[model samples]
Target: MKELRSQAIVLRTMPLGEADKLVTMLTREAGKVKAVARGSRKTKSKFSALVEPLTLGSFLLHAGKTFYTFIQGELLKSYTGLQHDLERFVHAQYFCEICDRCLPEGEPAEAVFHLLLTALETLEVDPHPARVARCFELNLLEELGLKPALDACRICGKSGGPFRFDPLEGGLVCAECPRPASSFPVSAASLAVMKRLLAYGFQKLSVCLLSPQSQSEIHQVCLGLFQHIFDVRSLRSLQFLKAGKPS
Candidate 1:
């Protein structure tokens, strides 16, 4: 059997036959892989914690006739901190699902993998899961070739200050060059923050702040895009977030 090594984050896990598991991972080298982890359910199994959801590590996968088998896995960060919080776990799950949906077959997505793991670490370390989620959504849009028009209006090439994300049109629309269906509400400040999220790196967003209403506006904009591009609702984590106040 041939062996392969790759960096991966556990997307999900399901029970296989007795004492085994089917582990689905989003790999940096391979787009995604579903492999069998033998005896992962055993109490003394070395892969017990290593094969759980949200694990980031390197794995040795044996290419078998039927399916890949886990040979040995090493954990880099188990993200144990986030596990204690329900909202955080929801965020991680939704983020991983978005990633698994966007990537194509046979496409090596190293950047996406790193972005995901780093974003999860960011959520684990930082107090802003919602902000991190926004950052991830904007970056994902760009990576999947659906980069929003933050610079200028899609209708006109004018570079300016204020704009709104028109989901139906699929980009930002400036005040002057508006489409008939450009009815979605967005404030100048809200658009600026979103533009920053898209144009700059994640670190740039660390010190930024927005009002309560502004945060909702940013989320709605990105959610609209997510629905359009991926045909899915906002992150499942977000539903829990919206139900109550963040701790």
Candidate 2:
């Protein structure tokens, strides 16, 4: 057995057998790793609390042929703030789902790892989970090399207002150009907000005031981009979030 130590955030966990659990985590150094926590299902298990989803910790793992085994872990931050609110919890889950989908196994994804960590931390105190989510979506797309052209027209490289977003072309199409059949009209205000969200870091979202109309527009645009780029039909966590919200 080979011993390895790293800073990790628990992504998810599944029960393996009667007393053990299969843990999936995103590490700062090693990217995504799947390890088994022996006896984690038992009441007396030391790994039980530390392996919960969204917990950040330092983990010592024993590498085996198939999967690593959780040896020792020191809890850092459990992000308990997220658990207090249903909306926050679901949003956090959506963030984790995106990461699991976008990141490749056993690859070093330092940018994504840091992005998720920062997003999680922001979610703990940020009153507007939607803003954090939007920021995360835009940044995640950029990190995965799927960033849509928001500044200039994809066809003519012209920068101006009142553009339409073409999902198939993966960019904003200028008003002068012939719009694609799938292109949806986007207002100058909405486009500007999208650009600002992409350009700025998550921390700035706290002070940013986005109009209700702009929020809806940005949500639709980001959702369309996710479907077009990642082929994600629907995210379960997002569904839970919508269902839980007051109408």
Best by TM-score: 2
Q: If candidate 2 were superposed on the true structure by all CA atoms, what would the RMSD be? A: 1.9
Residue-wise C-alpha lDDT for candidate 1, range 120-150, written one tens digit per residue: 8788866777788778887888777776666
Q: Which candidate has the highest lDDT of all?
A: 2
Which residue pairs in candidate 1 have backbone atoms (N, alpha carbon, C) closer than 3 angstroms, thus clashing? none
Q: Each candidate's lDDT (Cα)?
A: 0.77, 0.83
Candidate 2 lDDT score relative to the true structure: 0.83
Query: Which segments of model 1 are wrong by more than 4 Å?
Result: 158-162, 175-183, 245-247
Where in model 2 is the C-alpha error above 4 Å?
Answer: 245-247
Model 1: number of backbone collisions: 0
TM-score of each: 0.87, 0.92
Write one digit per residue (lDDT tens) for candidate 2, span 33-72: 8999999999899988999998999999998898899889
